[model samples]
Target chain A: MAFMIAQRAYIKLYLINKVEQRRGYGYQMLEELKEEFKPFGYVPPQSEIYRALHELVQEGVLYRTKQLKGNDPSVDFQEIVLYHFTDNGAEKAALYKKQVKTDLDRCIGMLHKAVADNFV
Target chain B: MAFMIAQRAYIKLYLINKVEQRRGYGYQMLEELKEEFKPFGYVPPQSEIYRALHELVQEGVLYRTKQLKGNDPSVDFQEIVLYHFTDNGAEKAALYKKQVKTDLDRCIGMLHKAVADNFV
Candidate 1:
């Protein structure tokens, strides 16, 4: 499950980068994943998301930046950490994307065969 | 990946039970998995398979029985551990099979959208 979550996180970051041309914070990514899996009745917990992001950073696939979020500099702003892909991270994300697709296909095929054989 | 491995082990055991009406040892299941994934250029390591089986046993989904494999009484036979599904395990395997199918559908859908958008 951690592996799948990490893959999902990498793909999510890649999608976010492609669509928004900006980095993503952990909370935002968590919310996005939650929404994505909502139909499947699975809500990814915040801790898992944070842990996955941290793992990615550890893998040198991402770097973190701390930024304050607020329009007014005089106000006490919320601090957030944003994740950006490193050069190696970007290459890995692409590779992971392809690998994930292939894995999903194989898994689906296996499940179908199992179901057809009444093995489940 | 470990979670998936556990799931695969459960499913493989279920299939073996249905077809052969027998339980499976760790090495047999590992060889089966290796053959199954060989087309994809992936061979699961024996350690991972054993780890997954142990995890399933810990989860109360499987129980182990040590059996001697040899027809000769005078010779020392190989001791092999076979895995059998618990009552609860049988139920969980059925449930996991359905869940895996649903999860795979959602995952494939997400990947297709990502691919269509060129997000990967």
Candidate 2:
């Protein structure tokens, strides 16, 4: 199901871009994705999400920045890593979008042929 | 690409069913599929095709029969194994068709959302 894979990629990109206006921590994005996919009876594994994020970072589609969490100076603060799209990332995302569209159209055509051929 | 995987399955099933009126040898189906996907800049691998065929056979969706090739009885006849759908396979194919349709609808919806969100 290339479409499903493409859909997952699209959703992940969308969440990363739109989550808090193009910035979100990995766990936050994963949670959001889980919620989004809950209706479909599928919950993405955390490892898979993390792996995808790692890949995006590797591809320069995203950059990671670490920030200190909590405001108290006396307490040990947690480090939170947030992902943001690089300038090149946006262009790549656009290209990916176009590719996904092409793939979608192709799949639709194949499905139609399958149905018409009565061997679906 | 879940859609692509599903499409491959659909195509394989379709080819097996429609090729020469529902009976074709493995290599013949593979060649036909290669031709079908040629315009898309893809050629299904021999291993993948054979694997899919094996799986289908294991699933009882198809039964194989061995036939001798060539016209002369004295000639060393080449054995050709042709695959044909079983009674149960037609029913399974119908169910698979319905599932593919559902998956297609879901993918279309996701793609629309991805585009509408402008993250694609």
Candidate 3:
């Protein structure tokens, strides 16, 4: 099942945050991510990710930069790909962000209340 | 590669929204999603997503509920696997949300300014 319990759930959550509201977030990269130093902690598996990229490209949800490869001799290999949201997509992404944040806030609120109530 | 542009970017964005600052979002569902009726637009691939969930569990970032399947005759199928952010994780998730929101706001602001600049 492509949408197994864990993956499906994560994708739904990913969509909420990545695609649900942002105008052009259909299929693309994070707008601003500088946390590559702690790569493993912050990075997801790269192989499977490309598949999503391919689908997004086909769906017109995302566009990618011509691949750029650079060598930082002492460090591991580096390949930087730049993906940008279409104008229509970026606007939508922003709108979605608010809706998602609101939903997330509500959930956080409920969790807090549940904890306070000692309902653990 | 799992971390293809579309998938990698989305995962990074997903981590930002789902894990960066919020308390306990490591491997979980969107906090509150009642928009299931529009499954294709909002829903993601289930098979691939299961992988992320399984990994999160292995990393001790998430825990899952026993699977529960529902019967809604008209619907394709219904199965809900509830997930909860551990106490420690939820707090981190909340914190991450702020950082992400801030980063996003900055990007949005920049895009707005750039558009106004007519540099495109």
Best candidate per DockQ, number? 2
TM-score of each model, paired residue for residue: 0.55, 0.73, 0.30
Candidate no. 2 TM-score: 0.73
lDDT of each: 0.59, 0.64, 0.39
- The CA lDDT at B34 in model 1 is 68
Best by lDDT: 2
Give the winner by TM-score: 2 or 3. Answer: 2
State chain A's TM-score for model 3: 0.46
Share of native C-alpha contacts between chains A and B (below 8 angstroms) recovered by candidate 3: 0.04
Tens digits of lDDT, candidate 3, A28-116: 43332213213323343344345545554555545656442445545646446655565575555455445444444433333233233
Q: What C-alpha root-mean-square deviation, in Å, does candidate 2 show against the real structure?
A: 4.1
Docking class of 3: incorrect
The residue ranges of model 2 lying beyond 4 angstroms of the native Cα positions read A1-12, A73-76, A87-89, A95-116, B1-8, B99-101, B108-112
TM-score of 3: 0.30
Q: Report the Cα lDDT for residue A26, model 1.
A: 63
* DockQ of candidate model 2: 0.30
Candidate 1 wrong stretches, greater than 4 Å:
A1-23, A87-89, B1-17, B20-37, B40-120
